[model samples]
Target: MNTPTFRNWQSVQSEVLRRIHAREWPPGELIPNEADLAIEFGCARSTVNRALRSLAESGLLDRRRKAGTRVAAQPVAKATIDIAVIRHEVEEHGAKYGYQLITRRIAVPPVSVSGTMKTRAQDKLLHVRALHLADDAAYAVEDRWINTAIVPDAAAEPFDVLSANEWLIEHAPYTHGDISFSAVQADQGDAEVLGVAPLSALFAIDRVTWDNAAAVTKVRLLFLPGYKLRTQL
Candidate 1:
């Protein structure tokens, strides 16, 4: 084989992820040890270890004290979302779409949000709630809080037309963020907006977006039932 080329730790990690995705190292299959991988990639053993260590941290691999490394049975794959226009998502389903602004006001964020943001108790936030519709029927309910301290311009913009999800993504460039997801029983308000039975299971996604230095926004999305989030390796 041609000499394996990797210039840095990042390159080595990318190659390892690529191999795992390709099933060269299939789930539950033991990967080559550090020394073997180092020799194969023409890198130091430490370089290979660093790459494997990172994959383990990201839930892609399982490492044991003496049993060595194996592919995780359920790897946490990364997802990429292009800040799609709501109009696009609605149209793709062959429906006319619109947005209704329920409430928009400046207030202190809720305790849950405040805890995630680690902001002072009185820090101002632009709290907004809106219903996204597909041909006059509600499709999703977006409850969002924008850190006014991070994006002061959000206060002046009119969200009566554009969706908050689409707006912030376009205006703010974020370096990184954290997202968590779970299934939750819809509450009264969510049931009303999503046209579902109270206590019905709904897909809930909570996200924190940041602009390198500070958090820009924290949002919770309550999706209608039957919403499926699918991704390939």
Candidate 2:
């Protein structure tokens, strides 16, 4: 049989994925090292490395610095949610998007927020509150805190023409973050901003992102009733 040659990292990745799915490399089995994979695939070592790194990110393969890469005995299926531009998201749905900045201040946040953000209680953060509108009707209320120490440019931003949600995404790109989705009863502040009854059930997403080890921003977005989120595993 002619030796199979791969041209790019994606082709190598596809072949590796095929081997995994076909059980040619079974679960918990240590796969060949990158140098060996490179020789076998007729590609550069970096191509194999890139392919393996992609699989590792997706929880399919486990790679240790010194330890040989191995197939995950149990691969975790992850649903990735990309940070979205709300204006684009609303316009895609055929509604005119509007934004209103409700509050912008530099202040000490709550103790819980400080703890999660890894900032001292006395450390003042930039807090901005805004409302997103769809066809002039309330869509979501965004309450956010930005670490000016990490992103100094945010301190000068008024968040009037732009929302903090969209601003931080463009400026401070985070390496990783935590996110949670829940059905929350609207508090008075959020209810007033979203124009919903206080205590009405709302879909809420609380997220905290960091640029490397330094905290970047923490935000909570409470959507009006009937908000639907869809993601794939």
By TM-score, the best candidate is: 2
| Poorest 10 consecutive residues by lDDT, candidate 2 | 77-86
Off by over 4 Å in 1: 1-85
**Model 2 lDDT per residue over 135-205, tens place:** 99999888899999999999989889888878877888789998899999998988888878999999999
- Collision pairs in model 2: none
TM-score of 2: 0.70
Superposition error at 217 for model 1 (Å) = 0.5
**lDDT, residue 210, model 2:** 88
RMSD of 2: 4.2
* Candidate with maximal lDDT: 2
lDDT of 2 at 7: 98
